[model samples]
Target chain A: DTAVSQTPKYLVTQMGNDKSIKCEQNLGHDTMYWYKQDSKKFLKIMFSYNNKELIINETVPNRFSPKSPDKAHLNLHINSLELGDSAVYFCASSLSGNQETQYFGPGTRLLVL
Target chain B: QQQVKQSPQSLIVQKGGISIINCAYENTAFDYFPWYQQFPGKGPALLIAIRPDVSEKKEGRFTISFNKSAKQFSLHIMDSQPGDSATYFCAANYLGGKLIFGQGTELSVKP
Candidate 1:
């Protein structure tokens, strides 16, 4: 069984299209996060949710939104995707708000043409 | 400013040799430092981690050397193997639920 899992490991979409990536964690955790890894391999935090409540939202564009239906699931929706949106998106979960180890999913490579 | 800086963006080491990667951070508030290893087309997995209170920690052939005063940390792999080839990243974080990652370092273990 996978501790964290993401669907559509690879996604190729055209510009101005909308797409969503789903993530789920089998481990009982209270916090989840979304990170974007660019071509330069720089990983940055985009959003974090604690107990299904949005806690930390970085300077992400309005087109990108994260929804946590429950403590074990977090989904990211991107509207009108742009070429610069091409990157590897990773989902991670921690046991609590902080000071805990994080487990990451395989990742979703999104390519915007 | 780049919060965390990693040196030698890429490295090549002979199998059975030692592999070392260094990292430095600008934020003094970062009390926790972690190192992640990622394979191609895969997400990063936590290889090892250390806190400022400890000078160093070792697990098997992996070791983390932490310097609280210098705001620097490093990862050392003893008896590197071909299967150890991957990208390594150093990250720092405070009590917040966010982590600041350094540009990854690609390590190739030549057999």
Candidate 2:
């Protein structure tokens, strides 16, 4: 079984268009996170949720919003996407808020023109 | 204090050779350090990890050597095979906080 899964493996849209990426984990983890990997392969954490509650929010712009409906799912919605929004979005989950090991999903590639 | 610097943005090695990637951190608060391996079109996966309390940890041919005093850690792949070629990332976090990842090092193992 896929421990962590993400939807829309690829997305291509114009600037100002809104899009959403879905993520789900079946590892029975309590914490889930969203990360962005730029073209340079630099990975950065964007948001984190534990048991459906927001635990960490980085310096990301308001255009990027993360919603966790439960402990198993975390989704990212981007509004007014810009050219700079092009990157690979990844979802990860841990056993708990303090767990050290985090499993990552395949990732969703987004490109804005 | 939040950055993890990695060296040699890219590396090439012959089969059966050793591949090493080094990382340094400025934050003393970081206690958990991990190395992730990522193949093309895939997300990064945890390859190995270590804590400040341990100087070294090894699993199979992959080993992590950490130096708390120097705030540096390195991943050494022994007898590297072509299948081991991938982008490796070093990350650090304190008490389960957000992980600060290094820029990444792409390893290419020649057959």
Candidate 3:
């Protein structure tokens, strides 16, 4: 069984458009995170949410927003996307914050054209 | 500055050989270090981890060597196999929650 899952394996949108990526985890974890992997394969954390409450917010742009409806679901919404947003977005979850092992989804590859 | 720096952006190893990847962190407060492996089109999965209190931790064919004072860690894969080809990332957990990941290393095991 897949512990973590993400929708839209690939996304291609024009600039200034809006899109959303959904993630779900069945591991019964309380902390969820959004990460971005660039062309150089540099992985960086975008946001972290614990028990549906925002915890760590990186220096990401305001157009990128994360919404966690519950502990099992966390969605990312990007508004007015730009070419710079073209990268792979990964969704991860852990038991709670604090360096626990994180289970990651298959990831959503977003390409802003 | 890159908090966690990984060396060898890519690597090629022969089957049955050993593969090594190194990482260093700037934050001395980090206590938990983890290694993640990602195959093609897959998300990163936890492979092995170590704490500052221990110098080494071995799990099956994977081993992690940590140097707390130097803020450095390394992952060693023994008996490399074609199925083990993947990208490896080393990450340090600062103060518990936030994880700082190193630049990934793509390892290809040749059969």
Candidate 4:
């Protein structure tokens, strides 16, 4: 079974369109996270939820919002996407601790024209 | 602010040769260090990790050398195979916080 999964493996939208990416994990982990990987392959943590509580919010703009309905699901919604939004979005999960290894999903590739 | 920095943005190695990737962190608060390997179209996976207390940790052909004094660490793969070719990332975190990743290093193993 796939430990972590994300929907819409590929997304292409217009400059002003809005889009959402869904992520789910079956590892029974308590913490879920959203990451953005740019074209340079630089991975950065955008948001993190520990048991449905927001814990880490980086310097990301307000256009990117992350919602976690429960411990197993975390979704990202982008408002009025722009060209700079093109990148690979990844979801990760880990046990509710600091040093736990994070398991990542295949990733959702987003491109804004 | 780019806490972790990795070197040699890309590398190529012959089969059965050794592959090394190095990383340095500016934040001394980082206590946990890990190396992640990622294949094309796949998410990064943990390959090996080390803590500040230990200077070295080896698992099979993979070894992590950590220099806490210099705030640097490295991953060494022995007898590298073609299948081992992938992008490697080095990360660090303090007190189990959000991980700060380095600019990944793409490793290509040629047969």
Best by TM-score: 2
Native contacts, share recovered per candidate: 0.74, 0.77, 0.77, 0.81
Residue-pair clashes per prediction, in order, are 0, 0, 1, 1
Model 3 complex DockQ against the native? 0.75
lDDT of 4 at A49: 93
Candidate 1 lDDT over residue span B36-82, tens digit each? 99999989999999988999999999999998888889999999999
Judged by DockQ, which candidate is best? 2
- lDDT (0-100) at residue A53 of candidate 4? 93
Which CAPRI quality tier does the interface of model 1 achieve?
Answer: medium
Candidates' C-alpha lDDT: 0.92, 0.94, 0.91, 0.92
Could you tell me the TM-score of candidate 2? Answer: 0.98
For model 3, the superposed segments whose C-alpha errors exceed 4 Å read A97-99
Mind giving the per-residue lDDT tens digits that candidate 2 earns over B39-73? Answer: 99999999999989999999999999999999899
DockQ of each: 0.73, 0.78, 0.75, 0.76
Encode model 3's per-residue lDDT on B24-99: one tens digit a residue.
8887777689999999888999999888899999999999999888878899999999999999999988755678
Model 2: residue A55 alpha-carbon error in angstroms: 0.6
Ranking by DockQ: 2, 4, 3, 1
- Candidate 2, residue A53: lDDT: 94
Model 2 score (lDDT): 0.94
- Model 3 agreement with the true structure over A63-97: per-residue lDDT tens digits: 99999999899999999999999999999998864
